[model samples]
Target: MSEEILINSTPNETRVAMVENGMLQEVLIERNRKSSIVGNIYIGRVEKILPGLQAAFVNIGQSRAAFMHVTDVCSQEKLIRLEGQQAATQSDVSLPPISKMIHEGQRIIVQVYKDAIGSKGARVTCKLSIPSRFLVLLPDEPNVQTLSIR
Candidate 1:
C-alpha cells in the first residue's frame, strides 16, 4: 500500500488531497478570506446565559457569539478555571448549571471546535486541548499525558 499527500496553494485558496494506492481518500480546501476556526483559542467574554438551553453565548471577538454548553464548561476530565478566578469545585457525580458556572460579562478561555454555519454561531468549549507530534497538552491541567500511536 502506498499513500501520498498533495497540496496546492494559491493566493486566495489552498487545497489538500490524500491518495492511497492511486485512489483518492480525502480532500480539504481552505479559503484565505474565510478560513476555518475549528481549533482556534480565544479569551472571550460571556455575553449571555440561557438556563433553559443549559448553554451560554460567548463573545470571542467574532461577528457572531459562540455557543457553549454546560457539559463543555464543566468537564470531568478537565476542570475549566475562569480568568483571575479559582478553579471550580466539581465532583464525579454531576455538573452544575450553566448559570452557576458562568455569568454575564465574565472572561473565560475557550477553544472553537466547530465553524459557524449560516444562522448558527460557532461551537466552543472550555475543555481546551492542544495536540502536538507526541503528546496532547491540556492547559490548566496538572497531569501530563502522552499520545500512543500503534
Candidate 2:
C-alpha cells in the first residue's frame, strides 16, 4: 500500500488531497475569504447558561455565541473515571449541572468541534486536543499513547 499527499495553492485558495494506492481518499480546501474554524481554539466568555437544555452559550468574539453542552464541559478526569465504571453504573455517576459548573461572565478556553450552520453559532468543547505533523497532544491528560502509529 502507498500513501501520498498532494497540495495545491493559489492566491485566494489552497487545497490538499490525500491519496492511497493511486486513489483519492479525501480533499480539503481552504479559501482566504472564508476560512474554517473546526480546530481553532479560543478563550470564550460565558454568556448564558440554560438549565433546561443543560447547555451554555459562550461568546468567542464571533457574530454569534457558541453553544457548549454539559457533556462537553466536563473535564478529562471525570471522563476517564466514568470509563472505568460499568455500563450500568455510568448513569449513577452523572455529571453536575451546567449552571453549577460555570456561571455568567466567566472565561473559559474551548476548541471548535463543529462549524456554524444557518442562524446557529459554532459548537465548542473543553476537551481540546491539538494536532501536529507527528502527534496529537492532549493537555493535562494522562501520559499514555492510546493510538498505534502506522
The candidate that wins on TM-score is 2
Clashing pairs in 2: none
Give lDDT tens digits, candidate 1, residues 1-150.
Answer: 999999999998999998999988777898898778999999999999999999999999999999999988856644433333344555533566788889999999999999999989999999888976457888757777666665
Worst 10 residues of 1 by lDDT: 78-87
Error of 2 at 97 (Å): 0.6
Model 1: residue 54 alpha-carbon error in angstroms? 0.9
lDDT tens readout by residue for model 2, 7-47: 99999999999999998877888889866789999999999
Residue 49 shift from truth in candidate 1, angstroms: 0.3
* Error of model 2, residue 34, in angstroms: 3.1
Q: What is the lDDT of residue 115 in candidate 1?
A: 96
Show model 2 residue runs off by greater than 4 Å.
1-6, 10-13, 16-33, 79-92
| Candidate 1 positional error at 114, Å | 0.4
